[model samples]
Target: MLILAALLASAAPVPVASHERLSVIANGEKVGSVDAVRDHDHVAIHYDVKNNGRGPTMDETIELGADGLPQRWTLDGKATFGGDVHERLVRDGGTARWTDAMGARTAPARGTALYIGQSASPWALGLYARALLKAPGATLPALPGGRLRLDPLGPATIGGVDYRAFAISGIDLSPDLILLDKDDALFAVLDTGGATVREGHEGEVPALAALATRLTAQRYAALQQRFAHRIDAPVRIRNVRVFDPVTGTRGDPVSVVFADGRITGIQPPDAVASPGEASIDGAGGTLMPGLHDMHAHVSLESALLYLAAGVTSVRDMGNDNAFLPDLVRRIAAGEVAGPRITANGFLEGRSPYSARLGIVADSEAAALDAVRWYAARGYGQVKIYNSMNPAWVPAITREAHRLGMTVTGHIPAFTNADAMIAAGYDEVTHVNQLMLGWVLDPKEDTRTPLRLTAMKRTATLDLATPRVQRTIDRMAAAHIAHDPTAVTLELLMGGRDGAANPAVADYIGHLPIGLQRRRRQAIAPIAGPADAAAYDGAMAKVKQVLKLLHDRGIRLLPGTDDQTGLSVHRELQIYAEAGIPVPEVLRLATLAPEQYMGHDQQLGSIARGKLADFILLPGDPTRDLRELHRIAMVVKDGTLYFPSDIYPAFGVTPFAAAPKLTLPKAMPKAAGAGPAHDAMDEF
Candidate 1:
């Protein structure tokens, strides 16, 4: 009986070998593929592996062939197997043995004899026969080429073949085929690891098991279309009141279109829209190119606030490089909303403060290299701060200009504005730069002598003098733009009283608490009596300097060196206070800086092809400058944002009107009500 059983097992009709499909997946997503074969007790799976965004995969496969036999095997997709597999297997036991293609077997002498076959083995034959008798007909869902479908979770029978169903959830491989016998035991599982298994099919295990005999496949081309929109298309605005700051013209209602990120047309309101065009109603609001804060720190939140204020562009005079690139990228990608930014990186000088801001280049070579470093990084310009030696100016300027960057800075001590200008500084900041030419002693020590000398020296270099006129002429001729942050100086020099200026109150409540604290600290020490006269003298000098610059026909751009957010508007107000007409003051904030930066073509005005950066106010600012404080809406790059959304970023509260205070005018007739001197002293 033993001999007969052995012969029958050896001669049993073996099943044919056929290719089995396999899938590989990662993180529950299909990513690779393979072909496999299965035997009764074991299966060998051959698979073509490919990596999808995940790491490499190791998988195995098994399947039944057309000859009704099963084959199975393991596959290490990484192909890292080495050494003697047969030896290792032989050392284990008779139950586990490995053989090479040359028929060399590695196994330890053991109790059971090993049987291996390419077709269905004796164990497989028994299982197959049982499956055939139990199952007759079954089918599986069709799978696309290069894809695999996971068997659903549940009991199933295919062609009389019974399968014990259990889902392999979160399998990071695509499945190509599945196999089971009458015992419902899984014999083979083939997968590519790169196929996706959809949900809601757990109840279809029986159906999938029935079709396991046939291979199903699918192709994955990564679903590339996800929330992507082109921002390059032109946007048009119609029936808008256009403000052309360049020509000082407020044109009638017009239609403007901006495409390819530039203004392409400015036609009458009746113009027709071209193909692929989008239009927005202007609602009779004034349309002007975006405004700019000539000086601003480039904080992410602050940048957004600037945009929310209708500032389409800004010149970041100071910021760390570590954050600039990301900010630039975010702005360009239309991610977080903000205006186009032009960064200067940081100005190099010799003071402690300068070092904190940027490199402190004390020598000519260091200065030259500093300029080159910034220019190389694509900074729009180089700023020279207060402690630079006057001797380093020429080399720094030449190097910067050579690298296609502009040089602008504060006048060094002992150097007048004109001297710095003559030495190649393209621009000078603050009217203080020109103080040397007007001060009697050109020193900070005693205001009495300087004030007396300034008053007496009017004949020598009075702002109206020919020499002063020549200096101004030279600046204009050189196209040097001046950014007099007069408001900052006024606040700094006006002995703390300027902090309470009504204009500042409008935005002071919005300042970040930290900044507000710091600002108070900065001005607190200067508020006392000993320094009072000095502060007053400084304020007087700032005013005189601003007036002188304007009278000389030198271009003036408004900037606020004050607390970043609260000061921009304050600067505009100061410009108005500095004798610049209201309209002109608005122009300085809106267009002058753009022209100074050579960005006028795309940025300075609101017309066709320009960015949609403008503010909407209840009343025209030109008619009543104070109306600027009432920002109704701000449009930046075609997106509208409210000031309320921005104020908190700066730690400021929106402007709230205070109740009006009234006093009795007839009180002066009552002498006993208060002594005039006492009242005057109290005031």
Candidate 2:
């Protein structure tokens, strides 16, 4: 029996011999070959795989072994296989097992297995197959066996791990996945695909790759230097119109002194203090602590725009890439000027698209890993997105709080805002989340169980309703902050009609050409009969939800979910249109966000010891709120930037003369019997 078993195992497979050349064929088609080479303990079969066939070869697998040992194997097209290959293997090993259907086993000197697959997307499959043929065993999840030759691209820190980046051509990988073992073997690859691969190259792959490597390395080094610096510098601003956002009062012109980046004094106009100190004349313009756009995209350009718009601070609710620490460093060191930015690097979920930008945690273990990942990277909070399983929320929140990181995000599809808060969500976005909790039926897609029950009980919730007030009271008691992003909601609701509001029209000229073109194209499809009614109704619902949240006294912070730089100002205007008092609306943009971000003492007001981040407008914005559009100058951390300089950064040509402002005309009276239409009368 033992001899027969041995024969069966031996006949089962044979390892390739040293110096032996072998060809690999699947169904009579030549696919790859191996070049044999010998080392001390083992013989290495270096293989070359190629795919020249018109269609993607299917039901193919490579069986590998050494000497008489049966080595389990896998075939990966791109080094980073998409989908849940690992999980699939764990769940059902037989699904990926290699087997021959026909006959009794006959061992050959080398073994082979059939890979079963049908191309889903032909072009993508062809590319993947071609890559695999070019680099057989290259897709093997193991370290490279030789010293890697990398063109130094730059320095970068990914997921808090610092690395000197080197550009490697002909491979798609993220810098974070590149790894080198101690044996001088390249163990992993970083694929930067899509437009990002060609960002700096002017369309040349090699040149772009080299530039990417160098830029990444430089960025890493700069970040390290920035992190090393302790922020203890004293700052001062003089001759500014100080606005007390909390009190809705404009204080007398003053000179504010700051030490160690904290407000030290707020004095009358003529206070004389230290010599050789930085002083901003404020150009006789309004000065307040930097404005905060609570919801923003923290790109370098966006950061600059935020500053240009007099936004000294921002809270990035979501972002991809594990580069938050570096972004924070750049902003802090003034290396790349912008706001005092706080970021939630990514949300956690279980979808493919979500995995790319969020932490993919299908289990409690994975969820815990995600929390630690953000905490170690210096993220102040975690923003959860849709599709997250409610079961994971409590564990995620517990782990995050243990690490001192707050949790916030959209209430998941099946969960209501109340459940999310009870699960330890520090803040809720979008008033729609709350409204859905009250009126939606559980059986409908929009209804959550919490909402259905509340509605069945005839629960009336407004800023003052007991249920709504209780929720707010609990949040306040817990020191949890809210970011309503009322302006974004308004735009989504009111601006969907064919007619553009004044605020929207003003922004149209300022938008980047590319974005504007895209928007124009996008609107065309929605404007047609088939989609118009649905779009209009959806927008009206959004507005109704916002009014409900406001009537309930829920704390509202100004946030523009659009481009972070210019949209924030537009958001404030939208808030005014939503019936928020102009002064209160301005406060939401200025002091409110600062308080939510826990930087009230150092930001959100123009006082001694506060960071000098403010904008100068031609008129008082609190009076008309529209005055915000008249941006004369922007001061960020004591640095003055003129409108001319800021507009160019936005890819807009600053008009030598501001465009004539004319309100949209109402539909003409029937037969023109009434007074002649006045376009300027709308505002």
Candidate 3:
């Protein structure tokens, strides 16, 4: 997530003599700009970015103390999805106070107690790093919560200009990698898929982004080495009940055996263990097919989180074309830990609001070319974005369908879901995209955050209305599916400034402090009690629509556009809360998605002939959907992973303990014999 910079501009601006300009690049495209002005102890930063039709726009002002850390800071602006932002931090004497999404809080400051602003500009990272350099051990107690540590990544040369690189950890699951100039001022912030760099040095962003990704990959690779158990011998999980998706029931205790990445057999719990085999005591738990996130944007961190949440398969709705293919390769080559990905080609029409993920076409012919490009690259589907030309959908869908690729996406600007379905779209991407037609005027653009903000109008909507039923009827008649992303709606519209978000409340405490604070904040602007009630009513309406769709036999996909992996579980929870049976909800999360993507043969269930892709849970999920959260172990392609061993690396408290693993007795070696090709030796 990009930093949500400052809010409103200062009423009385201070003149500055020095200025630095930075460019915000996403997927190799320029999406935004940042201007920093310095005048003595005061620094003003104006940040604005517009990509995928929406980004944060804010102004930040900081008054530095003698130690070069902020003494007074103010930020006000709009968040990425149109949430209101007005954050402030003030340090006076030995006391520090600030107000953010978590409301106001006061903490005693003692000898450089650093304050990490919730909506600070990227420049704040450089400021924090500079101060931490002076702190003992390059670490300091941070405000709100947690500790900040600065680790040098050594030097980098971009465009023949030398700079020092550092990683600031503790605020998030992954550290923030930053490049600082010789003066210790901000120069660039590098990320896996995007970057913010000096204006003239934008040409080096791709290289810098790649380097950031490599650095992060190295860390995850080390984790994979320590946590991924890829043994060479048969592995048996004993005393576990297998959940049958088709039957919607858990069978009697059994011992499941797998070796060399395939399931070899399923036997009784009392079956005798063979030589050269490893055994795991499942402790009478349930062994079910690993869950699937129907909608996702995969990254290395999210990939690991998916496994921790017991999600083995994900259908990536959109991602960086170059980055995604490489990630897939590394995952397959065993360089990192991740879920099986089903990539969808991102197709957008070139406009000011175009999402810079994949092919951006300006003409109908170019759109068709984009489809062929995705087909050649083996993308399973084409995800049309908001800025695409409505007129081009028919041809794009036709081309994608001809290539045996599914067509799914948002309703393009100025068009409704009815039109896209008529144009041969196989599925609609977001629930708002489908429902906005019933509430918005023809001229109101769904290309912007209005797609989310407009849901407030749903409070007054009548599902029985002719226009609403017409769209639902057409989708049923056309056999078109809908990915409601209901959890996203709940997160956007239902969050209050200081209250815990219902979508993620169950496990929010297990996350880092920074993430916990963020989850409690409202994403959609709720001005007053009336507006809050409207949003609440709107969320209720969203659930009602989900129930209607399910009752009408319209295939509903459980997807969270948010890619934390945990959200996918919340997505299924919302489905269950919408009156869908718990068993059916589990089916939607596992078998239905696999069947939708034609991946069921190998991935959707736990069977003797299927790939060894399942998760071990301490409880029966059929009895309670919440049991899905406590994942003891995950076997992906026969490689074992225990969540309890890997979650600490990301600052997450483990939810379940690892099951006991018993290895076969090692054969005594001959006095002069060479090493044997045995399972223990392989490990």
Candidate 4:
């Protein structure tokens, strides 16, 4: 989440004779802009994007050091979720010093070491590209840690202009693909569904976004060919104990046989192996069904990540209508490695604060039309977002139900969970969306950051109050489900500047430096000791609500609205911490979501004739949820994937060794083949 701040002042003029400007488009809508003024080696920038009622507002000043690297850089702004941002970086003589939410540090300026801003403008990518071209080997040692590399791609012609392209990596999990003019100035930053382009070239967004998608898809396809193992013969996972979701216990050691994308047999460990059957010695590890992330926003990177984390299936909460279905088709056809996806149609009311991810409708007929569009495309549900008119929900829900689609989303602005449940929602998307109703006055708009900052009020909320219980009772009465995404709230309310978030502290050291810093920074600003304590208490209150929901028979869906892969592990762990039994927590992450999504018949359990979607772990997750972090192998649709083989692609260290796989006598070769560790350089 790079915090590109969007000022709330008058709109900046489009590119003119005096200054250069770029338009920030999301889902075909121009929601923000970046304006920059340059003079010699000095540049002043004002970057702002207001989408979803909250985006950063930042002013930046930079002085270049002749090498295209910044000699001094300063940024002052409010972050996306309202955290304060006052970051500074300077290179003086032989020393480089910088300060951010993570505090200040000094390191010797050696070679072409570049200081990556924690809250820099998107233009920084262009600067980096220009500088890397001058560095030895087209690479430079980064300031905090690791090294950044630039890979020049072939020139592309967009809107009748030839532009150079490059992919830069070493900051985040995925490389940043950008386009530059002939002069090596950044012309545009392309993404899967949106893009930021020079003011006069707004019409090229669709083409560039498509190019971004194609490039990303090609990369993942190559990875699939390299790492995904599809044996010609059936695979028998021998000497593995199955964790039976129905019985909530580990079963006797068994041999699980699968081929042609279905589980064919579960037999005694000594069962005779067929002539063409492959074998993997699970060494008495626990085999459980692959996990499910009920709330997700999928991309090529996140898709591969989900598979590595043993999440074999996901329900995309919302995404670009054009991009998601095509990605799903590619994954299903085995051209890309990803979890099975069930996409949800997103519907939002047109407003200044509307989220720019999905279809925006301004009237009842338009909202109904959106529902029909999703249903026609086989979308499983429709997610209503903030800025949606409450008056439109009942009609929208009715149409969705008439089309055999489910409804799940935020309690729209100016409304509450009680209203949505009464109107009709199969499930509520986030716990904060529900809890806010109890603490907020009807006049206070939730579309703004107030929805999150007001969590402080939850510290004093009494769950026993009738107003709170009434909403719970209605949900229970209506059989409404909840995707607490408590892990998301934990990150929002409990994060502390300069300390790793407790939600990700266990594995922060294993991630790349950029992500490590991201997880350590706060999302919501805390003004004082009282504010911090209130936020902490708000998190505790969230867990209490989770306990109440579970005890009251309100179904809880394990979902992480935050990270794509690793965060779901923490979601289940949080459930256990919230007093849900470990066995039940495991069920919530596995079987419960499947049953709720109507996928239980073919995907949820380790039964004969079911799809072969499961994982092998050295320890039983039924005993300690942390064992999930050590998954050795994941079997999805009969394809074998070793996490140890894929982790390095994202600059992550392997948590467990891959199991030894033995092919049949005639084949006489190892079945699992993975990319070499050096393959990480390509990312």
Instruction: Tell me how candidate 4 scores on lDDT.
Output: 0.86
Relative to the true structure, candidate 1 has a C-alpha RMSD (angstroms) of 28.8
Q: Which is the winner by TM-score between candidate 1 and candidate 3?
A: 3
* Backbone clashes, each candidate: 68, 34, 6, 6
Residue runs of model 1 more than 4 Å from their true location after superposition: 1-240, 253-283, 345-347, 351-353, 440-477, 495-499, 509-541, 649-651, 655-683
Write one digit per residue (lDDT tens) for candidate 1, span 304-336. Answer: 556545566777776555456666776676555
Error of 1 at 421 (Å): 1.4
| Per-model TM values vs. the true structure | 0.54, 0.57, 0.94, 0.95
- lDDT string, candidate 4, 1-683, tens digits: 00110110112122222356888998888878889888767789999988888888899999876555688999999888878899999998668899988899999874367888888878888878877776657787788888889998778899989998889999898889999998777899989888999998889999999889988888899889877987767899999999878778899999999998899999999999987777898899999999999889999999988989999998889999888889989998989999999888999998888898879998989999999999998887899999899999999999999999989999998989999998889999899999999988888899999989999999989999999999999989889999988888888887899999988888888898888887888889888899999999998899999999999999998888854598899999988888999988888888888898888999878999999999999988998998999999999999988899888888887789998787665453333344432211111
Candidate 2, 556: how far from true, in Å? 2.0
Off by over 4 Å in 4: 1-19, 668-683
Q: How much lDDT does each candidate structure score?
A: 0.50, 0.49, 0.85, 0.86
How many pairs in model 1 have backbone atoms within 3 A of each other, for residues 3 or more apart or on separate chains, i.e. clashes? 68
Error of 3 at 618 (Å): 0.9
Better-scoring candidate (TM-score), 1 or 2:
2
The full ranking of all candidates by TM-score, starting with the best, is 4, 3, 2, 1
What is the lDDT for 83 in model 3? 78
lDDT for residue 151 in candidate 2, whole number 0-100: 44
* TM-score between candidate 4 and the true structure: 0.95
